[model samples]
Target: MLSIILLAVALSIDACIVAFSYSLTLNKNLIKNAFIFSFSSAFFQAFMPIVGFFIMYYFGLKFIELAKKIDHFIVFFIFLFLGIKIIKDAFKNETIQIEKNLSFKIVFSLSVATSLDALAAGVLIFSSKLDILDCIFIIFVITFVLCFMSFCIAKSIKLNIKLLQIISAIIIILIGFKILIEHTIKHI
Candidate 1:
């Protein structure tokens, strides 16, 4: 149980950063939009692992093994792209003032983008020796709670929005690199 909770918190760190970014753009009703993104992220994070677990348990280990490599590559590439984009935007001095309300489409898209790493995490969890259902539930709970807390902190801060975004991007990129290295070492 403790290990499951720890893993969940580690996985949710990325979602928390994303949620904080979204919060910067949402002024009024920030909590509502935060909740939407948080819940969606938590749901996907939880859902993907269970799906991976069942597929691995029922079918065979071959698929899971194949997926692990793909997941690592995808996450690494996605974070690399995002980090470059953020760095470029930082230099361009193109500031985006967060609006009071966020559109449903925007929220949904952001949720998906931020949770992509969690999808890879799901595959990793499935390949591990943990209890699948319990791990998923713990991940969902931790992600949702951490996301909410990040939103609250974002709302309270008065820092430069662009800088905050760049920091978040850097953190994500670092995590991606870490994941890639870990997986590569395991496979080798």
Candidate 2:
């Protein structure tokens, strides 16, 4: 349960960042724009994992026996790579430029783009003991709450986005280490 919650937080960071970033630019229709983006981000973040999970569940089943031997490594590598990627992306010069006139296309694209990591993370769900529905609910709730809060927060203060990304990366890497350690101890 704790692990699921932690993963939810890590996965939702992207949505939160998007909401915060968008909110920073939005001057009018703050409530409407925030709600649309938050819901969109949350929906994709929740849905992509199920897609990834089913993809892995069907294909990965064939490799179950072999996978068990190195599942920890796979999970760790996925998270470590994700964490590194977050940090790396934070350093890049490119930034998403959105028109003040928030459109459905832009919202959808941002939601999908930000949730891609959750797709890879869905692969890890096979290794966890928790139910997929539970994971989905937790993820959906956490993401919506965080993103909505990000919008609220952005209205009041400017945030240091790079710093937030780095922090999120650290948390993800630590979760990977936690899973690795737990698996090793269990096997031993």
lDDT of 1 by residue, 1-188 (tens): 78678768877776787677656645588767778778887887787777666766677677767776676777677667766665565567455644566667555654555555565455566677777777888888888999988988988988877777567667767866876898789889
Clashing pairs in 2: none
Clashes of each: 0, 0
Q: What are the runs in model 1 whose C-alpha is more than 4 Å off? A: 21-28, 87-135
lDDT to native, each model: 0.71, 0.72
Give the range where candidate 2 is weakest over 10 consecutive residues by summed lDDT: 93-102
Candidate with best TM-score: 1
Native-vs-model 2 lDDT?
0.72
Residue 6 of model 2: what lDDT?
92
| Candidate maximizing lDDT | 2
